[model samples]
Target: MNHEVIGGIPVLWADAPGPLEAVLMFGCGVQDETLRTLGTTHMVEHLAMSTLPRLHHEHNASVDLLTTQFTCTGRPEQVVAFLAAVCEALTALPLERIEQEAGVLAAEDGRVADPATAELLSHRYGVQGLGLAAYRGPGADRIPVEAVQEAVDRFFHRGNAVLVLTGPPPADLRLPLPDGERPDRSAALPVLRTGPSWREEDVPGPGLALHGDLDDPALQLACKLLSQRLRDTVRHRHGLSYDVGGDAVLAGPGHGERTLCLDAREGQEQRVAELLWEEALRLARECPTEDELAEEIAELREVYQDPRSTTCELGEAAGALLFGGTYQDPQTRLAVLEKVTPDEVRQAFAAALETVLLVVPCGTEVDPKLPDGRPLPRRACGTEGELPPGAKVFRPPLVDRLRSSDARRARLAVDGRGLWAREPDGTVHHVPFTEVVGVEMRGPGRVVFGRDTCVIPVVPELWAGIGPAVDAVDAAVPGQLRYPASAFRPAD
Candidate 1:
């Protein structure tokens, strides 16, 4: 492996002597954009490829908090052609197809979520910088053509990019990207007002999701060990959950977010939730055994040594360069893993108790207390307001797809200070506007008020005349209470 500077861009080259794989990574992602410009990078990516000829190779693009990646894999000739075409297309993006590409992005957003990434980031990071995961990406309807062009000029540049390849660089490849300097990607650590918080979500099945904000490598190893213990105890010994595991992800440069998830069977939701807490409490009180640490280290080695495609490895290397992380060989990483002490792992587990955020299945309740005995707040206080007498109350139907016998009916009152909802089983919930931390417009005629403990989903059907109510609430609530829902436009 070697690193060189090509046209002022970093190139990470590795020799695998097989089919060619290439990845071009840019240093700007969602974290680089303000709420107003959220999704601009994505829009540029779409428009860049909107007119490319489909080749007999695998190609895809992805946007993350700190990096955007375009990857291709195939025979050597195919790889060369695909990458060359991408570079040419990026240089002259078809801005005329912006509207069509925006529609495509909207359709992509409506698909079922892979809760592992976005769901976790939203809760752990809050609705601030990277936490936009909780809501939809930038609303394509809001960003104009000028914004997209500016993004391309600022981020898609030689100085801010990295190209990685399994073989040598393609001959005569022309990468005519701009020569802009790398944008500063640093920001203050995300502060969660209700952090170590618990929230529920609409998911396909039952699961217990937890994440901690400790960024140390030793803590990362501890997360792996804890995940294995939960899997063994809950799945094998207790038969309460079908799957359980934990992992640490990079939130930014040198910052790691750890997540532990447990999936429950049909009737074991509550039981699994209870067991998860019990285990967490017990782990906090005791250090892992030496044998446990040894086993985990051995498993880590296996993972590091496992064979993977060169393209995949190159993409990872390129992403690391973009995010201010250095690429570590498997041996170096294993050495670090081996030196981690049991006491260090235990201390990390204990520290994690302070920053834990619990994401449980909807309708499943878990105690929100931290292991060290601090009560988590359930609602935002000042946002609450007194209801005015005879305020206009509007009961709108649930979104068409969500309208079922079991779906609850949501009522929004203009100038009433809050929302009232009734469940199918006769339960009434009053969530005040002051308590709302954020609001998301799900689609046409659908809105969700985000509270600490729950979310209020209101479907103002077409012609329900509830637009005034939404406007009034938006005006009445504090600026931060409205999550950037406008960033997410519904599919056409």
Candidate 2:
């Protein structure tokens, strides 16, 4: 790869057969925003792109869990103009367009990951960082103007950006972004669960997540082989599923989550979920055959050897540079892959299985087991116990409690330190005021969100006379952490 510095931003380029394709990437994305400012990065991207006049080029921009990219494919001059306009827009964004763009964003309603994968991430990392993928924070229309300005000042700048291209930079290329230091993201987000467990969610199909080294070639191959096997057995053979896919998300250097999600046929969710887990256990215990390993390697080799992948490879290198990761070239990676034995693949996968988190469609029953014959426990968000001492208790409305046995047992409590809720099943959820990440103000209620993924709803429908509880929450949580409930969401 050829490297240069243009307008104070690092540029990585490689020769390839294509009209000039350029990707300007920023290290910040959804992970950088707070729940109160969830869509700030995306809002920034839309605001910038909205400023561009119509041009005869293929161009788009996107924000994912960890990065934002503005890409374009066109003649050399067209590419130059596109990048220049993007930088100019970032430097002096059109704040006046906020209202119009918020509506646009609401209509877009984009999600970074699929439902099952997003739920797995949330279960693993709580409600911050990558886990934010599972939530829709405050609506775009509710995003504060100050938050948008702060996002731009902190992340959209020359110091935090990289330029990757399929060809050399044109002479007129200009990146006029304001100068700023790269934000520190070296600390890995705390993992909420290192689990060999399962949970039910409102997903279309079943999914599996393993927390492990993102750079492990064996684990990568294992995931690829698992998907291939699932496609053969679930889709082609038994007709239980139509699609099998997965993703590897980077959390920090050498660490992340790898997920495999499969869409199941109707009325067969439970069977498909069981099959998915059974296949994973089989691979972990028995290991892949030499031919299976070779087949995956051959497929990867085809992908890496293609000339069209030059831009993709350069983009990977640029991401590694932006974050703190080691990037291996295609040849080096292939060499490493070729040396991986079936036993190594088995061990890597088996070790990862220790941190496996499985998600199945709601209403589907699954009792999965580990290779050692231990049942994977069901995971729930709260502790199994009673509420804390000296807490002010609020019960469900008397009329509703008279009609339902579960309502009589459910209760909410508030103490000097935090809020708590006890479900009919005796699971207690606590969210301390000090750790309160966000508090959404429903019409006459409050939904408290905590750092540990515990949520306590102080809504009148659930508990009678919640005015006192709502007032207490407002007094304790800082004003900055509070926002009106999203208009797009129904009251809960």
In terms of lDDT, which candidate is strongest?
A: 2
lDDT of 2 by residue, 59-159 (tens): 99999999999999999999999999999999889999999999899999999999999999999988888999998888998899999999999999998
The candidate that achieves the highest TM-score relative to the unseen native structure? 2
What TM-score number comes out for model 1? Answer: 0.76
Full-model lDDT for every candidate: 0.64, 0.92
Give the runs in model 2 whose Cα sits over 4 Å from its true position.
none
Provide backbone clash counts, one per model.
4, 0
Cα RMSD for candidates in order: 6.0, 1.3
Worst 10 residues of 2 by lDDT: 483-492
- TM-score for each predicted model, relative to the true structure: 0.76, 0.97
For 366-419, candidate 1 gives per-residue lDDT tens digits of: 665566677744432123333345777665444632665453343445554776
CA shift at 152, candidate 2, in angstroms? 0.9
